[model samples]
Target: MTDEPRLSAQDMIERLGPVLSRRTRIRAVTALLAGVAGAVFVGTLWWSEPGPLPGRTHLAFALFTMFCLTWAGYGGWLVTRRVALFATDRVIAAWIGLAASLATTAVIIVVAVQRGTSVGLALVVGGLFVAVALVLAVRAHARRAALLRRMHELSGREER
Candidate 1:
């Protein structure tokens, strides 16, 4: 009998045997979702409400809803992809949440710069959005890293 462990989908890819197994399909889906979320967020700025004061105090939140949806779509993609790979949904949700928050912030900045009546005030408004986005992104990244580590441990155990 052979002493080698049974070859898995990942192993098949290494041998160049039609690399796109179910697992690869999942990862690719996650990556594609992330890319799509980012693109939608950057592209959606044209619809934000212009403001005289350039602050959230007056801006409507319909655009914000879109941002959240984009994020959710990405997360769903990630989870589905991960499920296909190793049956784990770790870090996928976090990635989507982070991308959504940042995209919303970007939209706010665009609105402030292009639609705000005052240039100086618009910069201040945009700056605040950037700061918030930075904090959210950092938090999301940290959380995702932790979850990914846990997933790795679980996956290792499964292999054994």
Candidate 2:
């Protein structure tokens, strides 16, 4: 056996606990709050409409509301399970979030253009969403790189 001492299971757990818990809590709360707020806003609009709406509009609202609820459910699961999300998992999740943001932005822009109303506002909001998503993606990638570098350093030390 190598002379280097290893961390005990408890020590490893203690080391990881703070890092994982903070990330998990932040992600869970963000997801839950965004999802619930989106759902409520969309639902309110759909319910309080002044006149009859097209079937497609109804369908769109339902789908968007469902999408928000899905995120909320995911957040709830994360909170309840407190699963350990690794750096790679975070990278993947960030990419998924970026894609979702892009698609949603595209849809919003299309709808605004078709309606000929608030097109500029839609574009502005969409840009913000895409920007946030891009930032998250970049941060995730940087984090993963850092973790990989740390892993390599530890392995190199162990080999010596």
Candidate 3:
């Protein structure tokens, strides 16, 4: 007889509640921090010039926050699922995050262009987000690789 205990769907969900809540709280706090930092950065840049274009910058920051939150939520979901996140999942998540960032960047760029703001600024913001995404994705990939390697080594030793 197996020692594993059977659990129903509701039981599983109930058991996962605390874990999910913890994940959600962490994500929310991190998102809040990012939002504040983004707002400050964009606000400083947008208001640096003597004009009425701060509104466009605010809009850009809003979109950027939305994208970041969405990406973070995806990442948090992956973590909460307890899946053996492989390098492939990391790469895929990075791609999805990049896609979300690019989409938001495009929208902001369009807004900035319509408001007669400098396009270079929007490009800079987009590039910054891409860079961050790349770093995170690479780190996640490395972690996954290390974990797999350790598992392989342990399993091989058990056969001796």
Q: Which candidate is the best by lDDT?
A: 2
lDDT of 2 by residue, 1-160 (tens): 9997886444454577564576667887788788899999999999998899986588678878877887777677666754334465567557767777777777777777778788788778888988998998999999988876766676566567
For model 1, the run of ten residues with the poorest summed lDDT: 81-90
Clashes of each: 0, 0, 0
| Candidate 2 structure lDDT | 0.74
- Displacement of the residue 55 alpha carbon in candidate 2, Å: 4.6
State residue 76's C-alpha deviation in candidate 2, in Å.
2.9
- lDDT of residue 123 for candidate 2: 79
- What candidate 1 gets wrong by more than 4 Å, as runs, is 1-117, 157-160
lDDT per residue (tens digit) for residues 32-151 in model 1: 575566546644653453645345533434455455455556555654542233323334544455565555556656665666544565456656665665666566667667766766
- Computed on alpha carbons, the lDDT of every model, listed in order, comes to 0.54, 0.74, 0.64
1-160, model 3: which lDDT tens digit per residue?
Answer: 8998665434444465453456545654565566456656655665575756556566765666556565556555555554333355556666767777777778768887898989898999988997887787788778788867866665566556
Clashes of 1: 0
Off by over 4 Å in 2: 1-19, 33-52, 80-84, 88-93, 117-121
| Best candidate (score: TM-score) | 2
Go through the candidates in order and give the C-alpha RMSD of each one to the true structure: 10.1, 4.3, 8.6
